[model samples]
Target: MDRSSQCDEPSSPAESPSPPAAHGENEKNAQFLTGLRLYGVLIGTSVASFLISLDTSVISTAIPSITTQFHSTPDITWYASAYPLTLCSLQPLSGKLTTIFSPRWTYQTFFIIFLLGSLLCGVAPNSSTFILGRAVAGAGGRLSLYSFGTILGPIMGGALTEKVGWRWCFYINLPAGAVTVATLFLFFHPPQKKPATPLTPREKLLQLDLLGCVLFTASIVMVLLALQWGGNQHPWNSPLIIALFTGFSITIIAFTIWEQRQGDSAMIPLSVLLRRSVLFSVLFASLLLSSFVIPVYYLPEWFQIVLGATPLQSGIYMLPSVISQLLGAIFSGVLAKRIPYYNPWFFLGSSLLCIASGLYTTFTVFSTPPAKWISFQILQGLGCGLAAQMPLLTVQATLITSPAQIPLGISLVLFAQYFGSSLAQSIGGAIFQNILASQLEQEAGLDKTQIQELLRAGNAKVRETVAESFPQSLNAVLEAYNMSIFRVFWFPVTGSAVAFILAGGIEWVDLRDMASSEGSENRVVDEFSKPGAKQGGSRAGV
Candidate 1:
């Protein structure tokens, strides 16, 4: 059982491996930061993480406000999907950019880009600018920082939307980002690395794989257009939508061929993708992460629309789920440390997700009990939390013996997460919009124009508008929204079921044992964690 056999082709060395001296951080430069200085850097990184994480889900609660302001109900899917679309597309390139430039410089550049994106979003006069700004903000440099934002973004967004305005959601990021820039400039510094030789401009551009990125991005955009337009704006049988789907398949094939040719220089290296554990991790992570995001986006809508809660109230309503998720993640880490296997945790989590998604399907216009919703949310959160982080960990453990694959493996898992989330939001919007339209037309007797008007008015405002004009039809319209939202549960249910199936196929090893030897521990730190040694000390474990 050689490690190379795990890949489709034997694992090859990197195209241009870093030199011995470039292993990261010279001994003399590794002096410890102490007193106030270390704390400043730590707080700075955490604040940066917080801001990035907040951006990931902040739009969840602001959608209704944004839709109202832009009056672009047709483009609602783009509002949610745009960020993830760009985020997923650029994630692989971020690491390469970080390596080519120093981390500090790269960090500063991305932060500035993110700040500009936020400013644009805050002052956006039209839907196109807002969506473009979101895409730019989403593609801001690091996936790891975004992961933290996903955890707390909804609550922050909801509160901001309620207190100030939806614009403040974007505006808040400006000051926070300014602080991050200041801190990084003042406190953060990685040892400088001089390339063995200066590279030509063409060589530098080739290292970034710009062509492959464009092809892959184009393919994804085609798939999104197909999904967004089919059976919604256009018929499923329409030639335009069909052509988009066809183009997606062709471009994906071309991208695959290109990746194979690039070998080690490929953005998502072909050899790493061929590994069985890596494959399973990508699938499982996509499914599980989608499960997490679907609820985050929709539950607030449910709270505001069905229960007549304000934005702040909707955020408050989500406390059970958010709190439970954090608890479950903490417990899962503790359990993983002690247990030799991960399948039990996976099974437990997915089973809970299945039950929670099923329970959500039971929600109705009259289902206003706080306890029922809270309990269901808690269950769903616990389920996703328990298994959400496992895919990455399991992939790392599988490649413990093949350290070079760790970075690619981690990146693939993360890419699946963002990509799946993008798909989930797009599909959810399509389903909800289509069903809501039909339900309003057939059940509530609203015409096409009226339905569009109502949707453009915003979810909370829709109820108010209808109640004032057609009081008798209010209940019917609310019921239509309820049923339409309930239908969205199927997405997470199916995602959880698939995750449960994939979890069983994951390869597991005793991670603690894998890192027991000092040399192996160093290897784990070198491979799975950050590239450079810390200013103060070295960290152990994968």
Candidate 2:
């Protein structure tokens, strides 16, 4: 069992304080050591982060090419879904895994896996094969990479689309990953292993919660599958959807009961869940993530349908938002150190995102001002960056006193965001796509066959339209696109409102209390660090 996954220490409702270690810390002076050296870890993490974030958007430009190559929407869609599916499901497990394996090795292991997966993805010969590769690479995909890539997506998109071909985006990881692996090996020596006393056999056997783990797994997997296939494969009322949803609900309930019953030995410690900062951050992060994700998922479709840009060109246009996200993460991390009152950054960010989403809600037809679109996105991007570290910061402030749950706690917050996104994108996509299809049918007097043919035109599809009169058909599609996008903004606005509410709720656990609690927690985090830890596990936040 991954140590990070099954923590031995009491995670919440702080157990009776054992004798403070001779040198043990207290709430007053928790682990400031990690915070002091935040830059070193932050910088290294940023490099890895940029690579991952770059991957998400880099593919946005290539979806057309992917659809053209794969010749199926489901296949192309799998490339995106597969990565998140695995990434989301395994998040909490990583916390446990890190405990057993140690952070340096844990990070290195995933980095290698992601890199190898990227190589296979870039060279895949068939759609199924490519999807398999994407799944592998995205399996336990790194979080920092996702944030960094999102931050610098604009730069990467420009470089990948303009200077090189779209496929190279995946291929680009080869050198970067190599350098990262080599650098870590060369420079990052592991901290001396503190001699941990062996666990009693009874303790080990008693600690296992296989039933809870299995139930949690079932809950997330069922939900994600339902979301993926709900609208596209089966109608909302279909038996398959109902069965899947039913399974999801039952499993989730079981997992929750199992966790609460299990307590300290639970898959996710209850104390962690009850922690005000961790709890609020996870909720807010989940809501905010919906806003961030819909744009990435839908904007490409909008660009292709409305802007008449190529798959690659659309990728470039979406770059600025990602660039802004990177700046936000770095700026916020630095700013928090200077300005002790952290909620303002989150407030400013959520407010800006709300404003942007509100503005987008009133978008015009294809003739809407480009500046307006760009500006709102930039504002949205800024909000994303600002909020990036705040939730994590909140966890450090209010919930995780130990380094043991630090990464796990971090993963939980991210998992929530992804969970929210998965739900939103799957449902939201259905709504937008369904709306687009119906509106297009009304506008284009064209039948399904004609629409399929039009969609097949892709980057150069319109230029090759069989009928020169296709623009009339396109009008309905564009009109639908405009309205659907308008609807999409509501998700962000509502999410922002929720995030703002949660931000107000997190208790400001002082940083002084962090080091001691962190040290104690780090001591016990040895039980749970599976790569598949919290991916889609029982916990909504994890």
Candidate 3:
């Protein structure tokens, strides 16, 4: 596909091999990374992913604290949604800026912005201030990390809850962001990105699309708010939710049309989505990845409620998956460089996830063993390791023909990521709720006596009658909740199956194929690197 015309064209230099070589250790690392052909963008993005994942996951633990602090649930979801909404909204822009502004500067600037937002969130005096801080933190949160990994390297995703606690998830970005900035500045100096030629002031001014930016933000905001509120706050049929949806829909439509009319200056080009491969990749990516919502949020909840573990212990249970994920991502990158192929890995990843989820579904209160749970998670992690970054490999490979398309491709990946998580969260929540409702009804099987008791409790406004039914209701709700949650794995399983099937159609494009045809090539390496390869050290970032 002609990704350049199809998507927002990045202004960066062609992503070629041979980084002009760095000094001593840098040179060795560079060679190794190049040999594995590491994506520098991935290193920066891994850091970003750590921060963003932490922001999303750590909050569940802190919610009780937040509730105590704020004295209400009035805007609980607001705290979490602020960052994702911003990340989703700014994704298209951020993905491009990495190429337009030099990935170095784009990352540095956004990491700082993220850090500042984190600081404000950590020190927030009240819920409103904290939410505002999260909003600011969110702007670059999703934008920085999501595709930088794909554009440059295999970045690992994770939360910050382990070391600093829930608040630290936001606060932890301070030092981590600083360390990331320092690492890039000190060790990684990208080639100077001079424009092809100097542009006239008018030409440069004309290139800037202020209206496009405004429209993009407006569209994302409306869509996110509508999603957050609809079926949760107001009924799905409410006017406000309806209005927001319509406004966002129209805005997006107008933006698409306007971009086509503007031609080269369009924020997002129409051609990107037009390509079957690009379009299908995005769809499959979203569909398969949507299943991650269960692991991200509910895993901790499960540990807390079902196994009766502390937040920290729950975080520990996740350590295996998270660590394995890091290993899997790096291994895939290294493998891709050492050998070449993507289709099998993609399918394997989806299959593993499906099987893993299916395994988790077997968990039971009295019948199950502890080892069974861990064993299933291990298999799931193995699959996760395989497929997680392989999609990016294809996406990046697909865009190699048009370096300009890299930014939009990366942005789409990030946008798809959080958007998938958010959508899955909502859908999964509803699924869990319905299961809980039905299970509770069946368990209680309330009779006329219970109904009379309920009426008496309500009419008399007495606590006694209500108390009688509450326990039964609560038990039913909890049991159903567990069932629904464990079942959430099926989402990714089903989505993954389709993704796996669709991936069989991807042309076995190799990195070596792109580099040179006449020069000597690692034909063997090309054949072997199906999933990906490890770039440098097995360095764990998050």
lDDT of each: 0.73, 0.60, 0.54
TM-score-based ranking, best first? 1, 2, 3
Quick one: best TM-score, which candidate?
Answer: 1
lDDT of 1 at 219: 95
Winner on lDDT between 1 and 3 is 1
Best by lDDT: 1
Candidate 2's displacement at residue 204, Å, is: 8.4
lDDT of 3 by residue, 174-223 (tens): 87777666655654445433456866756654565556767877886687
What's the C-alpha lDDT at position 143 in model 2? 32
> How does each model score on TM-score?
0.90, 0.76, 0.69
Model 1 lDDT per residue over 111-221, tens place: 778778889899999999999898888776342353356556777788888888899999998887777778767877655456769777688788998888899989988
lDDT (Cα, 0-100) at 247 in candidate 3: 98
Regions of model 1 farther than 4 Å from truth: 1-25, 35-37, 141-152, 508-522, 526-542
